[model samples]
Target: MKAIQISQFGSNDVLTYTELVKPQLNPGEVLVKNRAAGVNPIDWKTCSGGGAAPFIGDLPFIPGWEFAGTIEAVADDVEEFKQGDEVFGFIRFPERAGCFAEYIAAPADQISLRPDGLSAEAAAGLGLAGLTAWQALFDKGNLQASQQVVILAGAGGVGHLAVQLAKWMGARVVATASTENHEFLKELGADLVVDYKNESILDHVNNVDLVIDGVGGEVGIDALNCVKPGGTLVTLPSVTKDEVIAAGKAMKVKVEPIRAEPNCDQLDRLAGLYADRKLVLQIADTIPLEDIGKAFDASRTGKVKGKLILTL
Candidate 1:
């Protein structure tokens, strides 16, 4: 099968589209004929030798985390799916990654049926971002109805979905995005969209029950000020563990770092939400595997209205 692998980590130019033998399945794994692959910032970060995982591979390494595809075969122990089943999931991250290829052997436990009525492109967009948003809101934040939640980077891959899920949970959603996404976010059930560029988000929001922080930087620290006392602050790509702990303790706040895990049950629930029109996964653009570099660059602009997908 044709796969994009990096012989060395440096820049996007290092990602080479080359031919390699098709991977075979092991126990508890399934061979998927990938239909679409999701391009994440982590993929680029890993390619640039800046990710959390140690560079273990000699040269060529496949870098992709999630995919939506059809099952070509399954291991003996697999009982939940069969050949030809349409599925989607986040493959093991920062360890074994091959979703950028046309075929991959992934653990069956990680796979889930794609959201009903969603095309491969849409399903591909949901794997990481959807899980992060859903888990943060329900699993970590414990958000409830009548709560007020603020979603930083509201139009981003995870932020957009978080805004919708928080709204579905009956929370009043306040979001921050560029002026361009004001209407887009409002349509996604965000009750309030603040322009982070021109206005002061701190001036507009206070006593928020939960703050979902995707843009983790100095801004993440500032986000704590918006949350109500006892409110939880959830962040991805957190800078320092000790700093977060000390800040949370000083402010009498709860701070949680989010690293999204593969959960078929949560994916299934999100699928149902998509089928019911209660949620939507927006795709910013779809690129072929050959153009993976462009996709990676696009994701870092901090202006994407949605997720970027790579068509296998």
Candidate 2:
């Protein structure tokens, strides 16, 4: 099998496409033949040696976190999936499950059946960003219907999905993006779109029920002011304890930072929403497996509007 692996953490130049052995299935795991893989900021961060996990892999580590593929084989203990089943899921993400390769072995419960009417590209793109948005808006933030919610960086990977998910839950959605993405954000159900470069997000938006911060910086900390009293603010990257405490005192709202976890059950529920036509997928581009290096460069540019996928 051919895979893009990192022998050592450095730059994008550290990643190379080379031949490697496919992962062998373990008990309670299923071997999936990759069809499509999602590229994310975390992938690059890991490749560059700037993540929370220890870099202890023997040189040449496979570095993909999410994918959509079909089952090639299954462990005897796996009862829910069988050979030849089409599935998609976030595979042991952040820690790496080698989704960049042609095949991966992951726990059966971690993979869900792909929704009908969705392509492998869309399904592959849905895992990390989709789950991050879902968990932040619905799980951690406890957002409710008929409330106003502001999403920072609303045109990026998680922001685009958060905007749509908040709308699907009946919330009034306001998204922050550049002028070029106003129409795109609006289509994703952003009732109001602010150009982050030209306008102050808080100038026209205020008293929000929840704020999902996809871009964590000084601006993200300041975004806490937009939340209503007793409302919640969920930060995607990381919010310092001091930031959370200050937000609580100044705004009278709860401020929380969240890291997404892989939940197969949640993936199943999300799949059901897709099956019912409630959720939407926005893909920026799809590259073949052999062209993963180019895809990585595009994702690093931070100008891509939606998810970037690598088709196997």
lDDT of each: 0.86, 0.82
Q: Candidate 2: minimum summed lDDT over ten consecutive residues — where? A: 51-60
lDDT of 2: 0.82
In the range 119-206, model 2's lDDT, one tens digit per residue, is 7888888888899999999998898899899998899888998998899899999998989999999987899999888888889988
Which TM-score value belongs to model 1? 0.95
TM-score of each: 0.95, 0.93
All candidates: CA RMSD in angstroms?
A: 1.7, 2.2
Q: Which lDDT tens digits does candidate 1 get at residues 196-224? A: 88886799989889999877766777888
Query: Which one is best on TM-score?
Result: 1
RMSD of 2: 2.2
Off by over 4 Å in 1: 55-59, 93-96, 239-245
Residue 73 in candidate 2 has what lDDT? 93
